[model samples]
Each structure stands twice: as C-alpha cells, then as structure tokens.
Target: MMKQIEIRYATDADAVSLSKLIQRTILASNSKDYSHESLDLLCSIYGPEQVAERIKNEHILLCFEGVNPIGAAGLRGDYLRSVFVEPFHQGQGLGKLLVGEIEEIARQKSVSCLMVHSSITARRFYRALGFNVVKYQSSPEGPTILMSKSLS
Candidate 1:
C-alpha cells in the first residue's frame, strides 16, 4: 500500500522538527559543496527559535509522510527560501511537489516571478524547474546561485 502524504502550512509547534530536518539535510546533501564552517553557520541559523520566527513571518510549508515531517519550503514575498527534504526522501519528487505548491500560492497572491538563492547542491534542481541563473554570490553561509523563474 502507498503511504499517506500531506502538505500544509507549518505551525510554530513544528519549529523543532523542521529545524532538525533542515539541518540534517544540509549536513548530508550540502556538505560536499560547502565548507564545514558554512554548514555549521547554516545549521545555527535554523535553530528552533529561528524556525519559529520564520514560520510566523513567512509562508512555510511542510510535507508529512503520515505524521513525520519529511520536507519543507518557505515563501517570503516573491522569494523562495529554506527548501529542504529528508535525506532518505531525496530524489523522490517531494522537492518538486513543494516548489509547485509554493508557485501556486505565489500565483494566488499575484506574484509574477519567484526568486531563489540556490545552493550549489540545489542549482541543478532549480534549473530543472525552469529557474535561470541571475548570478553567483558568496556569503558567510557559502556560495549561492541567484536564480529566478517567471510565473507568467
């Protein structure tokens, strides 16, 4: 039998689990492309408190397999942020599903474009979803690819 899955807006109560999920995904998937210090810095920025603040300020979505949070993504204005999936669940199209949902939400809000600060690990994935590179940038968290997609 297929497992049940749900995607919905996240609540403040989900902060801890979301934080853990994001941090774990970063360490597992982004470690090869980012420095250890960068990973640590990114992880620190996603601690439970920060995640809670984001949930309150951004349109954050979480995907659950049964009751376990398996994926997450955030939409702040026209910007996409903090997209992550559980390492074991990667490559299974959950990321695409999350982004599609975000796009739909953006459309409902009259947003014509979506932008993402894509990590090196996620550049290809964003490109596959029709986001074109705007430029490359460096930050304390590490190198980032600025990408955008037209909703038009």
Candidate 2:
C-alpha cells in the first residue's frame, strides 16, 4: 500500500513540529551551501515561537505523508517563504507539490506575481519552477537569489 499524502494550511498547534522539520532540513540540505554560522542564524529564525507567529500571519502549508509532516512552505503577501522538505525525501516531488500549491493560493488572491529569496542551495530548484532571477542579495544569514514568477 502507498502512503497517503496530504497538504493543508498549518495552525498554531503545528508550530513545534514545523520548527523541527525546517531546522532539520536546513541543517541537512542547506549546510552544503551555507556556513555553520549561516545555518545557525537561519535555524534561529524558525524556532517554534517564531513559526507560531508566522502561522498566525502568513499562509503556511504543511505536507504530510500519513501523519508525518514531510514538507512545508509559506506565502506572505506576494512572497514565497520557508519552503523545505525532509532531506531523505528530496527528489520525490514534494517540494514541487508544495510550491505548486503556493502558486495556486497566490492566484486565488489575485496576486500577479510571486517572489522568493531563494537560498543558494535552492536557486536551481526555483529556476526549474520558472522563477527568473531578479538579483543576488547578501544577508547576515548568507547570500540569496531573489527570484520572481508571474502568475499571469
């Protein structure tokens, strides 16, 4: 039997699990491209408290395989944020599914365009999703590729 996959809007109750999932993904997948300091800083930004706050303010979605939260992504206004998938689950289409759902949400809100500050590790993935690089930017956490996709 195949595991059932479900994607749904996240709630405050999911904060702790989501935080752990994001932190784990960052350390495992993003560490290859970012410094230890950068990874630490990024992980700090996604702690349970912060994620709980974001759950209240943004459209955060969690993808579950059965009852396990395997992936997540968020949309705040026109910007896509915090897209992550479990390291062991990469290359399984979960990331693409999460982003596709985010795009549809943006379309429903009449958003003409969506933007993402892609981590160095995810730049190619974003490009493959049709986002064009707007520019490169530096932050305390590290370098990022700012990319955008038109919904129209």
Candidate 3:
C-alpha cells in the first residue's frame, strides 16, 4: 500500500527544512526550464530567511508522509506564491493536492479567483489544473507564466 500524505500549515520551525525542500525541488525539476544562474537566483530567494518570512506573512502548507515533508506551497491572499514537491515525491498528485487544499482555503475566504506566477517548468502543470495563462514575463529566473483560475 502507498503511504498517506498529510497536509498542514507550516510553522516557523519548519523554515530550514522547507527552504531545503524548495531548493532541491527547483534544482532537480526546473533545471530544464531555467539556466544555472536562474536556478541560483531561485535558490537564494527561497532560502531559509525568506521561508521564515513567508511562514509569518503567507499561508504556507506542507505535505508530509510520516513526519517527513515531501511538498510545500504558499498562498498570499488569492495568489499562490510558491509551490514545490520534492523531486522524488513528484508525479504522485502531491502538487495537485497542495493546489486543491489552498483553493479550498481561498473559497472559504470568499475569494473569487486564484492566481499564480508559475515557473516555466510548472506552466503545463498549472494549465492541467484549470489555470489559464494570462501573460508571460521575463525574469531573472527565465520566463514566468502568470496564470489564474476562477473560483466562482
């Protein structure tokens, strides 16, 4: 049988682990969509300090299997700020689970729509999840896809 994945809000103490997860996920999964310098920039932005601040400022959720986190996501207002599932943990619906959980939270708050600035690597994933691309922008980390899903 497959292990169960639990979802929960992130706490301050999870900053280091979460940051590491993000870094590893980005490096492993996004290298195809981003250059080395872009990956480095992403790693720097999602480091421990930033993770801690996000934990304090955003609604961040973690997916765990037997006390080990395999995925994480962040929401600020109606925007999905960041989402990452560990490399080994990908392709198991963890990313979809995270998005669903956050969308439910937004619905509870009466949010009319959900938005995300998706990494190029994740654009197809978001599109598969019912988000439409609004535009594209060049960033230090390569191209960013702006997407939105209506909750209504």
* lDDT (Cα, tens digit) per residue for candidate 3, span 1-152: 45987889999999999999999998999999898999999999999999999999999999998877789987899899779999987888889999999999889989899999999889889999999999999987788989999999
lDDT (Cα, tens digit) per residue for candidate 2, span 1-152: 32788899999899999999999999999999999999999999999999999999999989998777899999999999989999988888889999999999999999999999999999999999999999999999999999999999
Regions of candidate 2 where Cα sits further than 4 Å from its true position: none
TM-score against native, each model:
0.98, 0.97, 0.96
Candidates in descending lDDT order? 1, 2, 3
| lDDT scores of the candidates, listed in order | 0.94, 0.94, 0.91
Pairs that collide, model 3: none
- Candidate 1 local lDDT, residue 89: 91
Q: Regarding lDDT, does 1 or 3 come out ahead?
A: 1
Predicted structure 1, TM vs. truth: 0.98
